[model samples]
Target: MVRISSFGVGGKHKSTKFALYCVGLFGLALLVDLLWASSNSSPSIYQSIVSQENVVFPSFAQIKEEDKKKKDGIDKKRVLADNFADLDAPVLNWEKMANAPVPRLDGAAIQIKDQLFVFAGYGTIDYVHSHVDIYNFTDNTWGGRFDMPKEMAHSHLGMVTDGRYIYIVTGQYGPQCRGPTAQTFTLDTVTKKWRDLPPLPVPRYAPATQLWRGRLHVMGGSRENRHTPGTEHWSIAVKDGKALEKEWRSEIPIPRGGPHRACIVYNDRLYVIGGQEGDFMAKPGSPIFKCSRRNEIVFGDVYMLDDDMKWTSLPPMPKPDSHIEFAWAFVNKNSVVIVGGTTEKHPETKKMTLIGEIFHFEFDTQKWSVIGKLPYRVKTTLVGFWKGWLYFTSGQRDKGPEDPSPRKVLGETWRTKLEL
Candidate 1:
């Protein structure tokens, strides 16, 4: 190297050389930037895991608690008026059908052609299940067990179908809302095989999930342990013909409450009804509200999420709605139906009694009424409407205040055709 202070090399030449050197350095930096961007860009948030844990039965304590509640079998002479609450309720026209091959609840179900695929949920304290059972309507029986990639869920797992493929999103791996998993999976209804998609930005349990306009919309549920952090919504873009793209985006969280059991979409609008919103129970002296019990504070808040993704809190569950659980559905665009999960209070007896009451809500008028009563007092059951019948599967019935014994988790399945 030669000193340039004395202008040994021509002054102008030195300046030009320095300028060229700077340009070369800039080009090198640009090349590295392009390479990094290319390498980091990916289509999905998740990769794949080969081996996952198998779902075991619930904890021993829960099993013992359930055993205390279990009855020998269904009692044939069971009558609603004689055994349960709701003195003025009319009997609902439904009967026992067939028992589920596997006992599962709080899972997801989708009817594809003749097969009703029910997956995840707790099996034995809240033992997460890895197997998916397919109920064939044609044969009136269940098909072979479809094993999932992993074992997880109890109570809340996000599931929905596009009449093509079934999508299962986040949920707690173990029961008790502790192990929230982030991965998303899909099954081709025709092929009956499982495939992994992108992972959730954050793991969550009990978040409500549904398929809308070729995209998977997941919202609400517990972000932390059992504490719900208000209304948060996220969506992943899925293409037509059972294809999921690599795009996921955040949606406007609901203004107030979140979904408890499930969210129903009607007339391009989303409705959250009869969901467990808050963790706190009613105050000691505060009168228990409708759908909400003294300690088990539930909400019948009819929150509607419009096309603009805005939420409208409509009529809360019927005052004395009493059905603080999540087994609710819409008969059509005009009317809503709530079944199974219900309870009633008797002022004369001064006690809360468990009852299987069928309730109705009107969307246009925002009104609620007692339509009928389920034969057996049941709660947390799965309801699916197909053909002309509303099919209910696998739920527990508890002895009301009349009996303080632990409630039962049952595998009883039944169906009733809705005339309305």
Candidate 2:
């Protein structure tokens, strides 16, 4: 039988055991050196990667805050505050004058010599004022008052004065979102007589009207439906409240059409500025045309018509504005100053907001800037420039500083010196 020793082996076995021990020691030393090197270099490597990428990793709290702001509909880009401080404009000191006899909205005003004539307007939801209220700037009091013609419109009328005569055209006759009338009339301030003129081919609400050259031009308002934008442009030749043309002439259509736009003729150029595309409409099949606010877009679009009779687009207002209509005046013979109006609705609440800033559009630069701010935000205010002062009266005013939504119909008149 072959016998194996319990403890003894050949010389080859001893050499193999020694070689295995040496290899195990070397592996242990290599592993320890690798771990030490990794520990020393890890922080520097991480910092180098961050610096090269220029990345800032937001904390969990910061991420949450950003998400909250987005959900609240707070756009950091859309600013609603008055920016008059940023502009180089004259300082305005506002003073209160005598209030009108009645509060009204959507009224037309024209200055004739020392007197300001305020025409028909909306008194309440169901009532409309057809009286002509006159204010005397010289006496700082409400002067003579007269009733408009029985057939004349109550609100949304386009009015422009030529010395002694005030032309009234196209408007909602009654109240509660009624359709507009095509009937046109002229009022002689001296005789206080109403004369009929050629009716508009198309009826419009709060159209832009101006006496340009020898013809009276009317453009851009809401249609008879009271919501659709009207783009038709019409003109009529007139001399002393009499139409020289048998029928109204059709001119080039405006690029964009809407109501409550500020239209003026300056330096023989006709300009239309700051209007809206949509408006409050009547409910379907309602007899009285119950007014309901609809989805609308107010804009700051500006257009000019020269002797070429072509419409030219100009720089828009600093922001989208509407409801100005008569709330503009010529200042310094080089710029037009527009007062309180409406702007974009709140992003989250979707409620309409009123404007308080006075907008200045420079004819020379063809630019717009915020010159001053009103005492309170309002819409549909009547504006006039007389004797180096800017006068504004009668409109719907905002609720308060916190709430920009219109609340009260105001008849108070206010004015500020035109320093610039």
Candidate 3:
């Protein structure tokens, strides 16, 4: 019959079709939900790639502005940290060495190997040291004293060394602000004997002196009056501790001239640094040349003489400094370290002030920095550098931290490792 089997097969086919339709509707609903969620929240993979391509970056001007702000912040910090009185500066660890055999001031010191030779200086208002005091760096003691030539200047002398020979140039021959002597001499350290050189054509007091290009060059000192600034520069050919020329040759005058300046030859170039425009002069017609302070201007001018024998003005020190004729050394072969010296007078008190800050000058950058302070303020401190150590022997000390006036001459020796 039309049969129950055929009807059962058609019914099964109809149920299968309905199930397929229901599955299609569910899949469409899930796909639509995913599309709506992506549009409202997290991007789909295709949408993310398109967004990345359209992303904006900062402009060059904006980047520059940010960099400038950073630099300004750094500059402000540097300024805040530059105070000289700040305790965070480098520690010198200045250990006391042997006191000098005698107190002195305005002396010249030179180091040869393990020995430090202290030359003529002012011992007192009336007395001047006529002996050379030799300090043995190895033993940390003074030894092997010898008398300077009776004719040699006893104070305010300019001294420089080349090998075993020490050249002593023009200076005040006696105490009490006496006139300078034209006489110049050389002493052989090996023989401990002195030889006379042709006298400086013009006598100078505490002139800047150095050996450069086989010539002994001298410049910038007080004239005969002891107060007039001398700008004359002279040189004489020298070889083997002897003069090659019979007379001193004239060179270009220094722009400014005075005593107590430091001169050095580095990289075949000559440099002159720090001095005063005037000095104490002898009262007119006074016997023994009684000394009295005159109007003076401490200066920090720096000059460099090049291979072409032309001088170029260089950047000056932060403050005026003078009386540092021998208070300097070449450190690390790239910079100069100047020790204690005299600075500008106090603003209100009008009294002289001593410099305690260690001045560092860089040859490469032609810049200056206050590296450290001395144990106490001082002036005319004889300085020497040996085997990474800095040594200062004699000087005039300040009365106190607040009092800028000089108290007394000192013979104390101090040493510290060369940290900078």
Each prediction's TM-score against the native?
A: 0.67, 0.81, 0.78
Best by TM-score: 2
User: Which is better, 2 or 3, measured by TM-score?
Assistant: 2
After aligning candidate 2 to the native by TM-score, how far in Å is the CA of 210 from where it should be?
A: 0.9
Tens-digit lDDT string for candidate 3 (1-420): 555787788989999999999999998797667555544543333244445448433344644554575566644334433322222246578999999999998878888888899987888889899999998878889988899988888878888889889989989988898888999999999899999999999888999999998899999899988999999999998887798989999999998999899998888899999899888889888988999878788989999999778899999977678999899988787899998788766544556778888889998899998888788889999988888888999989998876657889999999998877
Better of 1 and 2 by TM-score: 2
Candidate 2 clashing pairs, residues 3+ apart or interchain: none
Ranking by lDDT: 2, 3, 1
- How do the residues 82-181 of candidate 1 rate in per-residue lDDT, one tens digit apiece? 4443545666578677788877656666666666777766665436577778777665676678787754444456777777787777776764334467
After TM-score superposition, the amount by which residue 321's alpha carbon in candidate 2 deviates from its true location, in angstroms, is 1.2
lDDT of 2 by residue, 67-104 (tens): 57557975443354442112234457899999999999
For model 1, what is the C-alpha lDDT against the true structure?
A: 0.61
Candidate-wise lDDT, in order? 0.61, 0.85, 0.84
TM-score of 3: 0.78
Question: Which candidate tops lDDT?
Answer: 2
